[model samples]
Target: MSSVLLFFQGLEHSPLSVGLRASEWMYPLVNTLHILGIALLVGPILILDWRVLHRRATPPVAALATVLLPVARGGFGLAVVAGSLLFITRPLDYAFNTLFQIKLVCIGLALLNIALLHWSKAWGLAIKDNQFSQSVRLACGLSLVFWLLVLALGRLVGYR
Candidate 1:
């Protein structure tokens, strides 16, 4: 307990500590970029999921993956960079914040969901044939939920 308390104290006193003492606009700028990256990441995933769910379009699964995967990856990469900077500005508070922990867990779950979708033969079939099975639909739904939660949890960092 003492060690943890000391760690937090050190973090609070660190020259890079985030708070009113930090440059006024820097934190918000980083946060804005992080949000934009999240928007980019979620947009394609949502669209692809909707298409798979509704059977509206029939683009080849691999083709769809090719188009969206890079966008999603780029967004993720940007978000990670921005988010790390944000954390660096206030490592101690963020490290202890429950909302931040939840956000990280949600991110992990979202990544796992994406990996599973890519690895599953059914998901490939759905993409290639543009015909999603019940399982694929369920996966899509879960993916949506997980990503949304990640966003919500991120917001909660400010409120809680």
Candidate 2:
């Protein structure tokens, strides 16, 4: 057997994994937290994205970001931790699932989009001067698409 398979098998058989699977309420609670985490993460992002995309910039990008970014980070952290816990319950199955893999890729793309936006000169201009450049707008638009795809694929991962 491949070492990769062995690793997943080991994860499935670990004490925490076994306990979570065996528990009546623990898995459900964790699943609920995952949903809530996604809500928290995506809600802020969508709102911020919408503001950026809007023709009339009522609330400035920097103002919205200052309020939303921290909440998004908190949500992302919770989702990752909870998602990791859930993955261990059936590591082999999820590790091989196509939807799960796609979801991961979409998440990577979303993160990359965020990084590019933050690292670009346009981001600074948008925040400091209320100047929304083409690049910043494009990044925000792509962020909406990528994150929405990630959300959909995450749901589909279970159905597969």
Native-referenced Cα lDDT, model 2: 0.91
Model 2 per-residue lDDT tens digits across residues 91-151: 9999999889989999999999999899988898788877787888899999999999989
Error of 1 at 117 (Å): 1.2
Find the candidate with the highest lDDT and give its number. 2
Number of colliding residue pairs in each model: 1, 0
Query: Residue pairs in steric clash, candidate 2?
Result: none
Using TM-score as the measure, which candidate wins?
Answer: 2
